[model samples]
Target: MDGISHITFIVRDLDRMAEFLCKGLGAKEAYDSAGNNYSLSREKFFVLGGIWLAAMEGDPPAERSYQHVAFAVSQSDLPAYQANLQALGVEILAPRGRVQGEGESLYFHDFDNHLFELHAGTLEQRLGRYGMGR
Candidate 1:
């Protein structure tokens, strides 16, 4: 495989996550099933910015950590994205300490305790800022 094929999230409320994905992140529903055969559980599929995301009915995580999926976003649009998340009632985490040249981020958690990040810098940019030639 050249890269990530998809990412599946286990969530307490499948429907809530579906709404979060659709309205909060502009993910289009790709499929819906009661878990009859495909995944063997109630699940919702979505396509967000060309990435496939799946949410399956399950227990919310017992805890959360810094491990998260960071999606690329432009610095100019970060504020609007934050506003959208606020309007959607998502939980925003405190900004973590970052290196000067790394980039900026908005960290947040979903209803199921899944952390996500919208990053506003490229890997190359961060490397250069770190004084390492990219």
Candidate 2:
């Protein structure tokens, strides 16, 4: 495959997820099914950082886990994302320990039990830091 075409999330409330995407994560709504089932069920689409993200109506996972999708973010904007997610009442997960130069990360769970991470580092940086085995 070339790369990720899109990421689809199974959510319960489209409106709520929309708010979380648009307001919390700075995503732009590309489409909304509006109760029209063109595919498997009702769905909505959003463009987040030039990536197509789909939110489909369905039963979310029953348990919360460490499984998550991470997005690249600048260090300066990390605090703003944290504040916005907190203001929206989203559950913020404690960040894991990290060595210097690996960069910062913010972890949180959405209403549908989907965990997300906003990371401020690139793979090269992470590998470089890890190479020292500190």
Candidate 3:
């Protein structure tokens, strides 16, 4: 209870969303309820790097937004992830480039219109980039 255990996002199609997360982000399907809600996780254990991507049914249709979230990844993994995403027919931001300071990073958006960023740097290095460290 010290921190957020999981996050849930409402999506229009469970199957499609699941596929997107699995293939595009390397998330594994952990569970799915009969109600069409599913969860994806990086590993079986819940640790500092453990993350869960849950998709639930939504109404009023799904719309794209500028709002986005980011995830950390190895710099070496960025190109492959981008390639995988492109293979899945996902739209990526143009002029894709990397920012280096504490660590290198790449930014892109997902099918659900969520912006996600991948960073390749240590915690301290990343924190310093945003002046989080002094």
Candidate 4:
């Protein structure tokens, strides 16, 4: 099946953004080149979920071009993750609850104004619900 191997985003501060996704979101720093790019993960699989948050060394444009990125998380660990985010003063877009018929999801923005949706359920589940199963 074709699944997302990773998602990358541009940030204003590489270190701060990396830390937030690594520590607050439980994603481990998978790789770094000492430049401006970094990869983080909690597992190793071809269809697995991974992320890359990066920032250019020079000055960025007046306005960023992207909106946000949403990550998937299990419902069981959400409370703990929420607490960690709260401790860091991270703003949440939605409280812990079901989103209409979309199961459970928590929305938030990263340091680069990129929004993220942490959802529950497996890749198959997501595909089935969203018509990606075909």
Candidate 5:
């Protein structure tokens, strides 16, 4: 099968989500439905490091969970991301324990309780560290 076509999030506010994506993660706003919904509801599109991310108007999850979408980031960029998110008044989650070689991560939740991760590790590095290398 082909790779992911796009990732969509059900957010309470399209504008807030757009700000979080653009200012917090450096995503560029590709399109805004602007009350014209060709899909389920009002939605906005963004391009994040070549990945298509969509945010739609809807009720978010009632509670937070570990389930989250992770974006690949450089190890050295974690601090910058953390600062940006903090300035946006986003909640930064404490990272779980990790092995030394697995690389670093920064986790946070958007206004609608959608969790996200900026991970510094590559799949190969994580697999090797976990002793599951191919």
Candidate 6:
């Protein structure tokens, strides 16, 4: 109830998802079964900048959409992050138009087509820009 406790992503390959989470999202591997004795299914856990993320082996989403989870980032780091993601061969999507003072974002997709965003703005800033007092 305080904040998001964890997020679970159903993916096709556990290793691939782990790689994306680590290399792209800067997540650390907290737990990995490595196909060890598991009860229900293959799964791995990571701490993405302190956010719990679990990837369980399974079929990916049926179709791609704008539905995505965005991580907060610093505006100065955005360019370098874009370059890194480019080097990793992540699919970069055309950025949406942004109003000044709202902040910036980098939108992209994982190899399996799950969309993600790295936003360089705070909730307070956005609310202020939108004329909603924080």
TM-scores for all predictions: 0.92, 0.95, 0.72, 0.63, 0.97, 0.92
What would you estimate as the lDDT of candidate 5? 0.93
Candidate 4 residue pairs that clash: 68-114, 68-115, 69-115, 69-116, 70-117
Worst 10 residues of 5 by lDDT: 32-41
What range of 10 consecutive residues in model 1 has the weakest lDDT sum? 34-43
Sorting all predicted structures by TM-score, with the top scorer first, yields 5, 2, 6, 1, 3, 4
Worst 10 residues of 6 by lDDT: 32-41
Model 2: per-residue lDDT, tens digit, 66-127? Answer: 99999999999999999998999997888898999999999999999999999999888888
**What's the C-alpha lDDT at position 44 in model 3?**
23
| TM-score of predicted structure 4 | 0.63
Per-residue C-alpha lDDT of model 5 across residues 12-112, encoded as one tens digit per residue: 99999999999999999999988678999999999998999999999899999999999999989899999999999998888899998998999899999
Which regions in candidate 6 have their CA more than 4 angstroms from the true location? 37-39
| 25-91: candidate 4 lDDT, tens digit per residue | 7766655556333434222211225544433333334453335555677788788888887777788
Winner of 2 and 5 under TM-score: 5
Candidate 6 per-residue lDDT over residues 33-134, each given as its tens digit: 776938367889999878999888878888899999999999998888888788788888899998888889999988777899999998898889989976
Alpha-carbon RMSD of each model: 1.4, 2.1, 5.2, 6.3, 0.8, 1.4
Off by over 4 Å in 3: 36-49, 60-66, 95-99, 127-134
lDDT of 3 by residue, 1-134 (tens): 68766766666666777777887777877766754333332222111247766667564135656565567788898899889888989876764443568776666765556666666777788678778995
Give the count of colliding residue pairs in each prediction: 1, 0, 1, 5, 0, 0
| lDDT (Cα, 0-100) at 79 in candidate 3 | 92
Residue 81 displacement (Å), model 3: 0.5
lDDT of 1 by residue, 1-134 (tens): 69888999999888889888888877899898965747657888899879999888877678998778888988898888888888989987889999886889999998888999999989898888888875
Q: All candidates' lDDT scores?
A: 0.86, 0.93, 0.65, 0.60, 0.93, 0.86
lDDT of 4: 0.60
Report the alpha-carbon TM-score of model 2 versus the true structure. Answer: 0.95
